[model samples]
Target: MSQNLAEPVAHDGCLLSDLAAALGVASDTADVRVTSVTSATDMAVPGSLFVALPGARTHGAAHAAAAAERGAVAALTDEAGAERTRAAGLPTVVHPAPREVLGRAAAFVYGTEPGDPRLIAVTGTNGKTTTTYLLHALFEALGVRDGLSGTVERRVGEHAVETRLSGRLTTPEADYLHGLVARMREERVEAASLEVSAQAITHHRVDGLLFDVAVFTNLTQDHLDDYGTLDNYFAAKLPLFTPERSRRGVTLIDDEWGRRLAAEAAVPMTTVSTDPGADADWHLATREVGLDRTEFDLTARDGRSLSSAVNQPGWFVALDTALSIVALTEIGYDLDRIDAALAGRGGLEARLPGRLDPVNPGGEGPRIYVDYGHTPASFRTVLTTLRGFTKGRLFMVFGADGDRDATKRPDMARSAALADVVVVTDYNPRFEDPAAIRATLVRTLEDEFPGLEHYEIPDSAEGIDKAVSLAEEGDIIFVGGHGHRQDVEVRGRLIPYSVKDAARAALAKHGWSTR
Candidate 1:
C-alpha cells in the first residue's frame, strides 16, 4: 500500500501549464498541485486527487467525506458529483466524463506519455496467458527485457511481482494499469505485454495507452452475461486491433473468427496459423506431439522455414506456438532470434495444471487434468482434444459457474455427455444456489444423452475423489473448471481451494504415485 518511490508524489502538482495541456483542460485559471491519484475513497491519501465515478450501485462522490478525511486534496467529478466534492473544500476538476480520463490524468501525474515504450497487447477469450509468456520469451531471446501482466503473474524482467489480479477480467483500471507500466519503465523494461480484457475495453481501462502491436488469438461464445450478445462482446474487443494511432496487428487464423478479423484489420497485418491453407504470413506445421515435447516446422512469409521444438504437452499448443511466432515477427525480430530463444524456452508453468501435464509418477491408473474450461466452446474443445488421446473411457468432472451466462450451461452438459462418464459439480457459486446450478446442468446432460453414465456430486472435492476411484487404465479423467484459481467464491467470501491441488490430493488418497 506504500507509495512507489519511482513515482514520487508531486505535492506541488506537476506544472499547471503542462497539466492543462496534457489533460486537454483549456481553462488557464485552473492551477493546482496533485500529490497522488486514487479511485477508491477509502484509499485516498492526503494531498491525493480522488476520482469520483459512477459505479454499478452508487456514485463514488457519495464517499467524498471518507476521501476528504483520508487526505484527498481535490476530486475529479462530473456535474452531478461536483457539488459534493466542492463542498468538502476540495478543488474540483469538473468534466463531462471523469472516469474515462482518469488513466490519462494518472499517466500525466506519473510523467509517462503514450507510446513511450514498446507496449504489446494480446486479447482473446483464451491463450492470453500462453501468448503473453510467449512474447516475453521472444523478448528475452532478442535481449529485450520486458514487463508482463496476465492472469498467472506479473513480471518486470525476471522479477515476478505478486499481483492482486486474476481470471478473464484481465485488465485492471487505467489508474493501476498506467501506474504498473510506469513502474515497468522505472525498472528499465524496454517492452511490456498485457492481456487486454473485453471488459477493459468496454470500461476504458486502457484508454490512454497505445499498443505498438495488438494480437488477436480468436473469439468465442463467452461473457454473455456482461455483453448480452456475442457480437457485442466481439465488438468491444475489436477496437484494440483497430487503434487509431497504433495499428500493427498479428492475428492467429486458426479459427474462423481470426480469419474474419484479419480481413477487417487496418494496421499492418500478419496472419499465423497451424492449419493448412492459411496463406498466412507465418505458418506452423505440426511434425510431432510427444508427451514431453512438440516439434513443428515454422515457415514465415519470406519463405524461410525454421524447425523448432516447444517443450509443452497439448496437441493444441500448435495454435499458441503459431501466434507466438507472429507476435515476435511483428515486433521486428527475425527467425534466427525466434528459434534460438524458443530452443531454450521452457514450458509455461502451472497453466495447463494436472490434466495436460504428466508430472505424476507412473502406475497412477489414469491421468487426471484440472482445467478452467466452463463455456460450451472451451468444454467441447478440451473434451474433444482429450478424447483424441484417450485409448480408454474419458471421465469428465465439471460444472458451470453460478449466476453467469446460464445459456451456456446446457451446452456444457451436451459436451460432457460426449464423455464416457460425466460427474457434475460446483465451481464458485457466488450468491446463486449451488444446487440449482448443478440441477440445471445435470438435467440438461441427462436429457441430451440419457444412456450416458452421469453422477451429481455438488461438492467439487468429493467429485474429484469419486472420479479418481472410477478411473481405469488408459482412461483420462478431466477435472475442468477453476484452473489456477486459489479460491472459490462461495456466497461472498473466498474459500481457499484449487482444482489442481484438490485433484492432486485425490490422486494421493487413491494410492496413486505423485512425484
Candidate 2:
C-alpha cells in the first residue's frame, strides 16, 4: 500500500537544522533542505528527511543507505542509528527516540499547525470506522468540505483513495497522517475525521496532532495479542483523551470502559448513552428499528431533543449516530442544523462500505451481507441485528484471522452460534497454519453446540458457495472477517480475493440473478 493518500501541493522546504531544532535534537547539517518526511525508505523522495527507528526484526537504521539511494537528503535517528546513517554519507539528527518524535517532525515538515482542518478523532474497540464515516457524512450534510481517514478508505472531499493492498491500516503511520492533513488543508477541507486505533496511539501515530474533539465508543476485549490484557488495551486508548491530544471529548457510557473513560478523561467531556437510566449528557432512545432504517431520538440533560434516523438496521447504528451527532454538537455545530440535515437527507447518507454492506440489494435469491466484524462483541451484535431482519434461516460464514488474538476464537464461535447455520472458513492465515485455525473454531462449535448445523470449509469462496446453495429465498447470508478487503493473506502472500464478489458468483451459480 502507498504510505500516504496525499501530500501538500506546495510547501516551502524546511532546513535540516530547523527540523532538528523543532524535534529538540542536535544536528550538524546547517543549510541542507528537507522538503518531506517519511519513515518508510521506499517513500523517500529528493530532499526528504528519513526517520529510521528500531524495529522488532531489524533496525530501520540498516536501511539508511537504501533511503539515501532513494533521494533522501538526511536521516533522523537515535545514537544507534546515527552512525549507520552518517556512514551512508547522509547527515543525521540524533534523538533519544526517533519514533516518539516522528509525528512532530512530520507536522513541522508539512507545516501542519494546531486546528489545521479542524481535526475530530474517534477511538474504541468497535464502531470507530463507522463513526468516522458518519462524522464525515455529517460534515458533507452540513455543506462543509471534509476529509476522512479510516479502515475502509481515505477521502478528500469527493475524491476517495482506494486501499492499496489487501487492506489499509485503521490508522496510517504518523508521517503519512500529517501529510494527509496537509493535503486536506491544500484542498481547503474545512474539517477532517480520523479513526484512531489503540495501536495508533501506542505506536505514536497521532502524537503531534491535537483534535478539536476526541470520541470514545464502547470498548470490549480486542487486540489481546498486543496489549496482553483488556486493561492495557483500554490504557492505550486513554491517552487520546488527554489535554495534549484533544481539547474536548465525547464518549459513550453504555459500557464500563466508556464510563471509566468519561471519568478519567482530562479534557472536557460530553457523555452519551442509549440506556435511559445511564447518567449522561445525551440519552439516545431507539424509536424504531425497521428493516432498512433505525429511528432514534437524542435527548439532552437540559431537556433539548433531536430526532434522527440511520439508514442502517441496528440499535448499535443508533448509538453510533448519536455519538456522531453529540460529537458535532460538542465541536460547536448547531443541533438544529444537524437535525435538519439528517431530516432533509432522509438520514445519514454515508454508505459504510463493508460495514453490514448488502451485497445483492435488489436482485437476489438470498440476502447477503459482507461485514468487517472480527471481534466477538462485533459478531454477536451483527448477528443479532441480522437475525431481526432475516425471515428465513441465517447463515453465518466467517473465520478467525491467524496470528492474531487466538484467545477470542472460541468466543467467536459462541457468537456465531447465534446463527441457525455456521460455515467456518479460512480468513487471513498469515504465517500460521490455516487448518489449525479452522480446527479450533470447529472444535469449539462442536463441543459447545453439538446439535447446531455447521460445515467446515477451508476455502472461503467454496464456503460461500456452500452457504448460498443451502440458503433458500428470504434467507440471509452474512460473510464476515474480510469485509471490504480485496485479498487474503496466507504464508505472507496476499492472494487476490473478495467476499462480496465471491458471494455474488455463488448466488449466480445457484441460478439466482445478481446485480
Candidate 3:
C-alpha cells in the first residue's frame, strides 16, 4: 500500500554516510543515497540497500547477484557477507553485528528513526492479539483514529482503512517494521497498537523504536523448540520492559510469571489482575456468569470501584479484557468515560476475533465455537468452560503443530479429554506425517482415560465434518488451534484452509440452513 503526499515537501532519501555514522563506522569512499532497506533478495528495488546476514545453514550473501540485478544500490552485512557481495560488483557496508543494527539502518533509509503515532506494544504467549484489538476498538469508540499490527491482520489508518498487511509474523523484521511506520506516518495515523511476539523480541525486530506503553499478557508454555525452557522464553520477553524498549509498562499480574515481571520490571510499571486474591492496580471480583456475558467489579488501587463484564464467557476473557481496561486508563484515557466507550463499541466480540468466538451457521443447531487456544493451559481453560455450558454433550476438535514443542502434544490431548467427546486432527504438520501426529494425540487420549470414546481424524477439515455430524441441538462443539488462520502448513507449504469455513461447509452439507 502506497500513500499520496503533497509534492511540495519532498521525502529526502537516506545517505549511506548517515548509516555508517549510526553504525559507528567511517565510510567516505562509498557515499551514496538509498530509499529503502531490506533483508530478503526478492524485495530489492531500485535505490534499495540489501542487508545480508548469516542464517542457520547458509548466508544471505548467497543471493547478492539477484539483489544487484533488481537495482539494489549497495549492501549491508557482516564481514562474511561483505566478501560475497563485493564479488557480485556491489559496494558493501560491513558490520560485525548486522541484525542488531538492522533497525537503525532501516529507520535511516525510511526516515522514521522517531516518528508520529503513539505506540502501544502487547506481549505474551496468549492474549496479545486480543488485547491489542480491544484497545483498537476502544480507541475507535472514543472517536480516535488509530492503527493495528497483530496476528490476525495489520491495518494502516486513514479515513478509509487499508489492511496493508496480514497473515504474517506477529512482529515483522527490523527493516520491515520501520518501513511500516513510515507508511503509517504517510497515512496520518495518530495512534497504534502492535502485538509483539517473543520471537520478535529475541530476534531484535523491535529494537530501534521506543514504545509509549508496553503491556504483558501473561506467559505460558510455548515456543519451547526455539527456547528449550520457560526461563529462556521469559528472558526473551524481558527486553520490552527495559528503559530502552518502552517508556512505561502496564503488566497483568494474574499468573506467577506476570507477578514476577511486575516485581522486577526495569521500567515504571502498573499492574492489573482478574484474580480475586491478587493485589495490584486492579483487583477483580465476579458478580455474575451468564451464557453470553460474565459481569465483574474491579477495585482500583486508588479506592475507586469500577463495574465491567467480559462480554463473553471464560475466565481467560475476563482476565484479558481487564488488562485492556487498566492499560487504557494508564495511557491517560479518562477513567470516568471508560465504561461508556465500551458500551458504545458493542462489547469485545465486535472488536476482536478468534477468542472463544461462536460461529453460528444455521438455525436451531448445536452451538459451535472457534478459538485460538492451542497450548495445554489454553485447551484446558476452553474445553472445560464449554463442557460446563453444554446441556447434552461437549465435543472438542483440535491438534498440535509438528516440528514444534512435541512435549506439549500429550498435554494438549489430556486437556481435550475434559470434554465428553474429542477428535484428534491435524493443525499444522509442516514437513511431518499427519497420520503419525494424529496417532500420538489419540494414543495420549487413550492412555489418559482408558476406553475413552474419541475419533482419530487426521485431516482437520474432515475432522470438523465428523464433529458437526455428531452434534445435537443442545450440544456445544468447539474447534481449536487454527482460529482465524486462513491456511495450514502441510509439508512446509501453506495450503488454503479455514476452520470457520469448514464448520459452515459441514453444516451446509448436513442440510442445515442459515436463519
Candidate 4:
C-alpha cells in the first residue's frame, strides 16, 4: 500500500550545504540540491535526500545504492553509515544520531515549520485516538481546514488515505509525517490534530514539530514490553509536554499518572478532570450515558460552562468531548463560537472507527460491536459500559497480541469476567504460537473464575461464529482486540481479515438479515 496519501506538490528545494549546516555536520556535496527527503529507499525520488539509520536487524545505510538508483541525490546518516553510503557512490552528510535529526531534515526539505497548521497533539495509553478524533471533528466544526493523524487512519480534511507503510502505525515515521504536514499546508489546512504515542516520542518520530496544544489523557499499563516498567512508559510521554515539543499542554487529572504529569510538565498547562472533587481548571460532569450518546456538562473553575453531548456511549466519550472543547479554547478559539458550532451540528458528532464501532446487520439478532481495546483497563471499561446496555447475555470475543506485553494477558482475561460468555481467539499472533496465547488466556479464566463459562477458539472467524451461534435476541457480542484492523498477523505475515466482516458473515449464516 502507498504510504503517502498526498505527494509534495513543488518547492524551490533546499541546498545540501544548508542541511549540513543545520545538522552541524560537514558534507562533501555542498552544492547538491535536495528537493525532498525520505527514510525508505522505495520512497526516494529524484533530488531526494535519503535518511539512513541503524536498525535492529539491518542498517539502512546498506540501501544507499538502491536509493541512489531511485534518484536520491544525497544521503544523511551516522559516521559509520557515511562510509557505506559513500562507497555506494552517494554524497553523504554524517550526523551522530541520524534518527534524532531525520524529522528536522525532512521538515527543512518539505518546508514545514512549527505552528503552520496550529498543531494539537494527544498522548496517552488509551484515549489518544478518541481524543484526537474529537479534536479533528471540533476543528471541522469551527470551519477550520484540518488534518488528522492517528492509529485508524490519516486524513487531510475529508480525504482519508491509506498509509504508504507496510503496516498501520499509531504514528508515521518522521519523514512521512513531515511530508503529511507539507501536504496539509498545500491544501491550506489551518489546524491539525495528531495522536502521539509513547513509541513515537521514544523513537524520535515526532521530532522537529512543535505543537500549539499538547494533551495528556490518562495513562495505564500496556507497553511494558517496550519500556520495561510503567514509570518508564510514563516518562516517555512526559517529553511531549516540554517546551521543545509543544507550546502549551492539557493534562487529564483523573489518575495518579495524570496528576503527577500536571505537576511535572515543564510547559504551562491547563488541568481537567472528570472527577468532581478534584480541583481542576475545567470539570467535565457526565449528565447521562445512553445506548447511542453520552451527554455532559463542561464547566470552568471561573464560572464558564458549556453543555454538550457526544454521539457515543460511555462517560469516557463525554470526557474526551470536554477535553477536546477545552483544547480548542486553549488554542484561542472562542467558547461561544464552539458552542454555537456544536449546537449547529446538534453536538459533537465524530465516528471513532474501531473504537467501539457497531456492526449491526439490521435484524433481531445479537448486537455485535468491534472495538480496539487490547489493554486490561480498556477491556474493563468497555465491558462494564457494554454490560449496562446489554439486556441479554454479554459475549466477549478477544485475544492478546503476540510480541507484546504478555504479562497483561491474564489481567485482560480477568477483565472479560464481566461478560457472561468469554470466547478466547487469536489476535495478531505475530510470531508467537497462537495456541499458546489462547492457552494463557484460557488458563487465566479457568483458574481465576472457575464459574465463568468460556471457550478457546484459535481461529478468529470460527470464534466469532461460535459467539453469534450462542447469542440470542437482545444479546450483545463484543468483539475486542482487533478493531479497525483490516488484517491479522500470524508467523510474521499479515493475513487479510476483518472482525466486522467475520461477525456480519456469521450473522448472515445464522438466518439473520445482513441487509
Candidate 5:
C-alpha cells in the first residue's frame, strides 16, 4: 500500500481538451497544455490553469494579470470573471459554475492515485475536532501513519502543514485540499481523517473526493447565521452521506437527525448508539465513568463485545468512541486487531487542544477548566458533566462570540444558569460591541434564572479574574467559549490572550503562590 502511493498511478496531468469537455466547455478552448490548477494567483505555477471564482466582495479574476505574470498557462472562470480575464489579456475557459468542477479539475492536475490514503470524513454540529483527533490517534495506535485536517491544524503526515497554515476556514478550499491529499500520498500515509463543516459542504469544498467512511457525531443547533435555520444546516450536512461524497457511512442515532439520516442516506450506512437497547449495529454499555477515565463495552449484534476504557467522561466520549469504532470496523479493519490496538492503552481518545482542558495554577486554588463549548447543546452537556463532579459551588465564566449565531447566546446564558455562579464576558467580539453582547446574555440570566449569583465583565482577562476572585479552595472555575485560542480578534486587531495566564495572575493577586 505504501509503495502504491509512493508513485503517481495516473497520467502526469490532464489534457486541456479533456478538462474542458468534462467541465462542459467549448472544444475550441482546449488547445492549451496545462500542468496544474490553482485558485490563488500568488500560487500559480508555470503552465498551471488558474481558476477565477466569483466572491461576495470581489471577483477572483481581478488578479488574473498577476497569475498570468506568474506563468499561469490558461484560466477558467464564469462570464463575469471571463470578462475581467479578457481585459487582462489572458486566455480563459468560461463555465457557468466554476466551483462545481474545481475539485475534479484539481484531481486531474494532481493525478489521484489508486493506493492513496483512505480518507474518512467527519461532520456534525459538535465533536468534529474531537472525533478527528481520536481517529488520527487511532491510526497511530494501529501503527499506520496518517494525516489530520481540522479547525486547529492541518497535517500532511505527522508534520503540521505550514505552507497554507490554518484558520482561513474549518476546511480549506477544494484545490488546496486536493493538493494537500496528493502531498500525503507522496508521504505514503495509509489513512487520513478530515473535519467536514456544514459550510464546507455547502460551498463544494470536498467536491470530488471519495471518502471511505463518513462519520456523523450528532446534529444540533449551529451555524444558523450562515444557513438561516437548523433544518437548512442539517441539509447542508446531509449531502456528505450521498454516494458522491462517501462510499459508506457511520452515524450516531442518539438524535432524531441521525436516525433520519440513516433512513435517507444515499450510500450504505451503519448505526452506532450509546443506548444499549436502541437496536444499533454497535451499542455501547457503560461500565464505569470517572473524572478522567471511562470504561465501556461495545456489544455487537452477534454477542461479541469490545470492552474498552477511554480517558474521559462517558457523556462526551462514549458516542465518539462507538462511532469511530464502527467506522473503522466497517472499513475492513480486523475486529481483534482493533480491540488489541485500542483497548491496550485506555482507548484512543486524543488529548484535544481545548475540550474541557483544565488550567492548573500551582497553589491550592480553585480547579479551573477552559473549554470551547459554545452551542446550546454543548453548553448543557458540558455544564451538567462539570456540575455532577463538584463538591463545592461550581462557578462559570463564559462569552458569546460576536458575528456568529446570535440566537444561541440566550440559550448559552440559560444553560450557564445551572451553575452556582456565572460570569458573563466577551470572547473575540469582532465588530459587535462587547458590552452589548454581555448585556444580552446577562439579560437572559435576569429573566430566566435570576436566583443564581452572576457578574459581568468586558473581556476574557477580566472574566477569568472575576471567576478566580470569587472562588474558594475546593470550588471549580469554569471558563467557557474560548479554549486553546491564542489571540482575540477585537475590532480587527489580533491581540494575544491566554486564559491560563489570567488564571495564574488571579491566583497571585489572591495571595496564592505557585507550588
Candidate 6:
C-alpha cells in the first residue's frame, strides 16, 4: 500500500457541502457543517458526525434516535439509519458502508499529516502483544522513544493507558484506532508498534492506515467461530503481508504457515526460525530459559551473528524476539541500540498470570499463578511451562468460556490433562450455559487423564478458593483463563471479577504474604 496516510486536516471543520463532495456522499441539501465524528453514541458530541453502522446482533440504525437526541449535528449511515436520522430532524450523510469510511472520514476531519517515525505492524493468531512489547523494547534499546498499541494496553514510553475492550476483537473501531495513532504522532514517538488483528482487516477498521514493516509471528487455531474454518482464518491474516498493505514483511518461520506466508508475501521479506533446517534469513540457536530470563544466539543469513537476552522466560518466545530484531533492523534501527532498549523490557504483567508469579516472597506456601489460557494451544504451553518449574505437584485451575468454538473444548481438556490436578471452573459464559461448558471440558480431561483429581466448580471465585485451599508448600497452583480481564460475563452483563486479583486474594487467605 502507499506509504502516505490521508491528511486529517484536509477537510477539517469543512461544511456539509464540502464533506459531501470530498466523501462522495450524495444528498439534496448538504447544509450540515461537520465538526467531528464518532462511532459511540454515548460519546456523540454536539456538531459531531455520528456514524451508525450495522452491528452483529442488531442494526446501529436502532440507536440513531439516541445519537441524535444526544446533540449530534448529523448522522452518517446506511439507508435505514438515514431515515431514522432524518425523522429525528438531524442532518444525514448516507453511505453504502459507513464503517468502511470512518477512519478516512475521521482523518479528514481531525488528523494532521503523517509523522516521521517508522510504523511497524505485528499480526498473527498469538504473541502479537508480546512481539509488539519486544519491538517497543528493542526500539527503546536503540535509543528510540516509541508508542505501543495492542491487546494488553497502549503505551508511549513509560506512560501506559489501560485498555477497556474485548480481547477476541483486537482491532478497535477505526475512529479510535486512528485517533490513537494521531496522538502518538503528536507525541513525537520515534517508532510506533501496533498489533493488527485479522478482524481489524476483515472489518475495515485499519483500512486507511499504512504499515511500514509488518511481522507475522505465527497463526494457529483461533477465532474459528468468527472465520468458520482454519483456511478462512489464515486468509484473514494474509492481507497485512500484501505489497499494497506493507512496505516490508518479516515472518517467523518456525511454523509451516509462516514459511508459506513468507513465500507468498509480495513485499521485501525476512524470515526467522528456531528450526535449524528451516529456510529463514535469521535463525535462533543456543537457547536458555529460566524463571526470570531467557538467552539465545542469533545467526543472520547475511553472516552476522549475535547473542541476545530477554527478561521474559517463555521458550516459544525466542523466535518472536528474533522476528522483532529483523523487523527493527530492516526498518533502520542499529543492532546495538536495539539490544539496549530491550534491556529494560520486562515480561507482560499477569499475561501468563500467576503461573510464574511467586505466591509470597517469604511465606512457606506453593507458588500460585493466574492466566487467561482458554485455547488448547495456550493450555498446553502453560501446563508445560509450569511443569518445568515444579518440584511437587502442578495444580491447574481452569475452565472454558461459554458460547465459543465448542470443538476446542476437547483440546483444552487434553491440555489440562498434562497437569497433576485439574479443577474446572466457569469462564465468561456470556449467553451460554456455564454448567454445560464446564462439563464438556471436565469430561474430556477425565477421559484421557482418568482418576486424576478433578473438580467442577461452576463459580470462578469459589473454584479459585478451592484450588488455593488445596495448595501446599513447594506446589504450584495455576488458575488459568481470563488473563487481564476484570469482569465475568453471566447472562449478558459483565460482573466485576479478576483472575489475578482472585489468585492473589486466595493465596493471601491461604497463609501467603504479599510480595
Number of the top candidate by TM-score? 4
Give the range of the ten consecutive residues with the poorest summed lDDT in model 3.
2-11
Better of 3 and 5 by TM-score: 5
> What residue pairs clash in candidate 5, if any at all?
none
Alpha-carbon RMSD to native, per candidate: 3.2, 2.0, 3.0, 1.7, 3.3, 4.3
Runs with alpha carbons beyond 4 Å of true place in candidate 6: 1-13, 32-35, 65-71, 112-117, 156-168, 340-363
Each prediction's TM-score versus the true structure: 0.90, 0.96, 0.92, 0.97, 0.93, 0.89
lDDT of 4 at 273: 90
Q: After superposition, how far is residue 476 of candidate 5 from its true place, in Å?
A: 1.4
lDDT against the true structure, each candidate = 0.74, 0.88, 0.79, 0.88, 0.80, 0.73
**TM-score of model 5 relative to the true fold?**
0.93
Q: After superposition, how far is residue 344 of candidate 4 from its true place, in Å?
A: 1.2
Model 4 TM-score, 2 decimals: 0.97
Question: Candidate 5's residue-wise lDDT over 454-509, tens digit each?
Answer: 98878678878878888887888888877777788888787898877787788778
lDDT of 3 at 434: 77
- Model 5: CA > 4 A from native: 1-11, 27-32, 69-71, 86-90, 113-115, 163-167, 361-363, 513-515
lDDT of 6: 0.73
Give me the displacement of residue 10 in model 3, in angstroms: 6.8
Candidate 3 lDDT, 1-515, residue by residue in tens: 52321111124667887788878976537677878777877667778788998999999999999998987888898888888888887778889999989988877777774437778899998889888877776677666778787777667764323333323688988877776677677767777888999999889899788888898988888899999999999989988999888888988776789888987889988888766666788787777766678777767878876676756786666767777767777667776687776665545443457888777835667888898868988888887777778899899999888888887888888888888889888888988787888888998988878877799888888998898898888888899988888889888588999888888888888866434
Model 2: CA > 4 A from native: 1-8, 161-167
What count of clashes does model 4 give? 3
Stronger candidate by lDDT (1 vs 3): 3
